[model samples]
Target chain A: MTARNLLLGLLAVLIAAPAVIGAYPLAVLILVLHYAYLGIAWNVMMGFAGLLSLGHALYVGLGAYVAAALYASFGLPALLGAIPAAIVATLAGLGIGALGFRFRVNGVYFALLTIAFAEFTRILFDHMGWTGGSSGFFLPVEHGQLNPIALRGPPVLFYYVALVMTAGAFVLARSLMRSRLGYAWLAIREDPDSAAASGVDVFRARMAAVAVSSALTSLGGVFYAFYYNNMYPEQIFSMARSIEIILAPIIGGLGTLFGPVLGSFVLTLLGEGTTGLLEHFGWAAPGAKQVIYGLALLVIVMVQPAGLWPWLAKRLRIGRDG
Target chain B: MTVYLDIVASGVLTGLVYGLMALGLSVIFGVVRVVNFAHGELTVAAMYMAWVMAGSLGVDPILTLPLIAAALFAIGYALQRHLVEPFIGRPEHEQFMLLLAVSIIVLNGLLLVFGPDARHVAVDYAYDSFELGPMLLDTVRVYAAAAAMVLALGLYLFFRFTDLGTAIRACADNLLGAQVVGLDVRRLYALTFGLGCALVGASGTLMVLMRDATPILAVQLTLLAFIVVIIGGLGSMAGALVGGVLIGVSEALAGFLLMPSLKSLFSYGLLILVLLLRPEGLMGRRA
Candidate 1:
């Protein structure tokens, strides 16, 4: 195959993979897209801007609860509620970014700070009665499933929505990487002092990263709230969720375009596959899968330092135009 | 008045153990730039080890301290060399990703190995207690506190004067500079991690004496240790002590004054307050 045809053919295969795989695989694809969307947004900070956030779940959980609360109490459509909820989350990230940067808190300290904010938010939600507290709040999937609500459509429609959102985020990050602001952010990431001395507005660029990343992450959360139809502190804001977000990027290859997507696919498949095996042999398997998951991550982190995506791409001789 | 005094005394006792747990965390963070996400699981591992040593061999839990310490030192060494040290010099995000992965694996590993059932040491400490006036304090709790204090003080001295401890601290302050000066940075990293894990083992042995343990406790204790370390200020020995007592007293006061249901609220709320008020913690250098 010629180079151009090979590239196009690969693209076609990616697009057609979910459609050909049937409903069960399509469901997995939806989860992949949702995770990729979040991972891409997270990457915009950790990967591109060099600001680590261990509590990206703060935005996801808060956005979800906000959207859920609006629909439940105000009887508003989630489409309308999603925008404002996202806006709030963006502002929250913006605030956190400002505080962190103002103090020159980079590296692990910044990661811990993000965690502190998210944990505090989780605590607040856990105690609050209005949004259903620890018992949790649910969105009516039945209502939106009918197509009138713009949210509760069929699994196919939701899958398509997630795909589009993930695609949009990928495109956004790609362009942002090429933009002047992107370069400034990269410069700041590499050397904050040198970047500032070179006339880069370090604060503004970092703030932009935080704002955009936060807003996109909230949109992913909106999908989560609508698709699952239920939300809880432990499920939404747990450290596990944060791990899920970062894993896609980390395993995919930090700062690489398709890394998060590939990471999400591999990790989710691992989880789903392990879970299925456990369920199939309940008596024999029990909790063995968890140990496997942990061991796999440790191995990957240590041995495959570049993550799964880049490694796989090199093996397949695909996607890496470089 | 009597009830208030009892509450305060109990809070102090609980705080001592908290202080001990935080000391290990502080030392590790001070030397290594990474947080030991699996530190709590190490504690749980020690708890199980203590249970086995005591239960199978009919050794007293108190007498098994040296065994716990030695076993934990080996485990900590292996964990550092095989599990953690490979990712040590990477960027902060990479280190975090690695440690978190290890944490997940270890927690689940314990699940697969030990099953989900919570186990207790079921020793004399479990039933022993001291009654002073209207207050009742468990003997294990008081013993654990006193033991922890002695051990923590010993560790403090270790850090203050020992050559190896100074090397660990020097590595923490200037990684590249220390390596240039011919310090065996790799060995230093391993020793520091082993020390940290060993300290956590000390914590778990005591915690098991006072209560039961499960695999899930690792994640929970890790979170609490995160809070304690942050409040104590990362890398500051004295900070961990103050932070632990403060958190303990705060929790106790909240437990007594507010509805018993709000205890967690008070703990996390205080965590947020500490982060906001003094991000450096009480004694940590300004970040």
Candidate 2:
């Protein structure tokens, strides 16, 4: 009961945060929320279903390109364009999952397959001229009055959109966790052979996990395109981007409701904080933040394999409801 | 017709060097059963080592191969003993993450040190070419290919005839059986990793002769290595060379026939096809 109230109170605080905080902090908050949303979506496949996808940037790039293309070509706003974008991404995931599961490309090979597909798509898009090719795809910016319908507005507007996404994804993840599919996913994850013996639809369950995860992640991609107003094939679909997506779930505590959110917050803040410190100290280093991320991943995996959220939850005496 | 022959001949040379790179990966996987995701980064690291050594010592980059090989072997052995040994029997994801993390660190560390600039050795024969009938092959590429072949032959012989090589093969055949036979599995794994890194180091030394050494090349090289290894079949040394030649030829043809950018498209397409049609690869045994 206390946790629920605390969550609602925290939600209220976030809703009112833009009024108090500066634009930079609000922007940071927005990035945190976006990553949190992506992490939650990615958690469905990797954390719950035990399918480690190293190429989730494939869906992100797909969603971004699809919606961005529709907007670029037809002037259809991103709000409506998100549907086809998500569908396209989901179909791609389904294709990959179908091929992998059918062929029994288990463990590391499945991860490699995902990478191959993502790299293949990235190269394909690199030469695709219609969507701007290697140059980049850009959306027109409206500087003056607010345009909520078109998703053209200030940082505060994006903050709220990101907030809604993070909260909605949290709710969705929570509900899925309580569902039969989620249980089956856990069964399959723990022991696929035993799960099969127990009458679990292992293949379908894994596919569903991939579908939901990809669809939700695509929505995050939609938000990314509109918010950034630009999409670069190299940056959008790079392995670095995929690593960023997975880091949160892995670091926060896989399969936990609050893990992704917590992990996102920690990662974004730490990354930004390090960059800020570097600036303050007049240390001009480019890949310092990524080095931090790599070090953090190594430390987290080696020291506390369960991740920070579980450890924090235990210390704070929080309920396992998360 | 001559142009096509020239491209094919050049690609075969490049492919031999690529095979040496993939040979290291195959050797490591065959024995240790842990895929080094950082293979390309380590290769780039070796390239940098060769580049720096050649510049400082005012010697040919080729001369630094043995020293770079020894250095990389030491690094690989230590890396395996300390970092990778724990995750030997653990879940695949853990090992993947460990190496992925290492890759990121190595890549970014290179970026920080090298500043994204393409560095190359100003070898005396940088522009020299050799002619074989109608085919014109770059002299450096021909030498690199010859060097790669020699190294590959050395590795094969080491595996076939050496006592330590037999012990390593025994370990790869059955870990439990090797343990039961009182072989030190940890040391052998480290030695195998060291040998693998040395193979790649030699390739990297040769690769710098063909292309510039840049941090950006790490990921592409890693993917290229992966494509070669998969196409050749995992755990098959000879398969690595065959896959390398196939990929090398296709890339050369694609560059001439299609677009240079589309060369990877063909390689990746081949990778997907191989995964779907023959997951075990051209020469890999089906487990």
The numbered model that scores best in lDDT is 2
Model 2 Cα lDDT, one tens digit per residue, A1-322: 4456757887999998998999899999999999999999999999999999988999999999898889888988878999999999999999999998887777777887888899899988999988889999998887874776667888888899999989999998888988999899999989999999999999999999999999999999999999999999899988889989999988899889888988988989998999899989998788888888888888887778778988988887778877
Candidate 1 per-residue lDDT, tens place, A30-99, comes to 8888998999999999888888888899999978888878887887777888999899999999998888
Worst 10 residues of 2 chain B by lDDT: B278-287
DockQ of every predicted complex? 0.52, 0.64
Q: Write the per-residue lDDT of candidate 2 for residues B166-242, one digit (tens) a residue.
A: 99999988889999999999999999999999988999999999889998788888888888988888656788898
Candidate number with greatest TM-score: 2
lDDT of 1 at B100: 82
lDDT by residue for model 1 over B104-220, one digit each (tens)? 777777777778788877765566778987888768778888888888889888888999878888898898899999999988888988898878888788878866779867865
lDDT for A189 (candidate 1): 82
Task: Enumerate clash totals for all models, in the order shown.
Answer: 3, 0
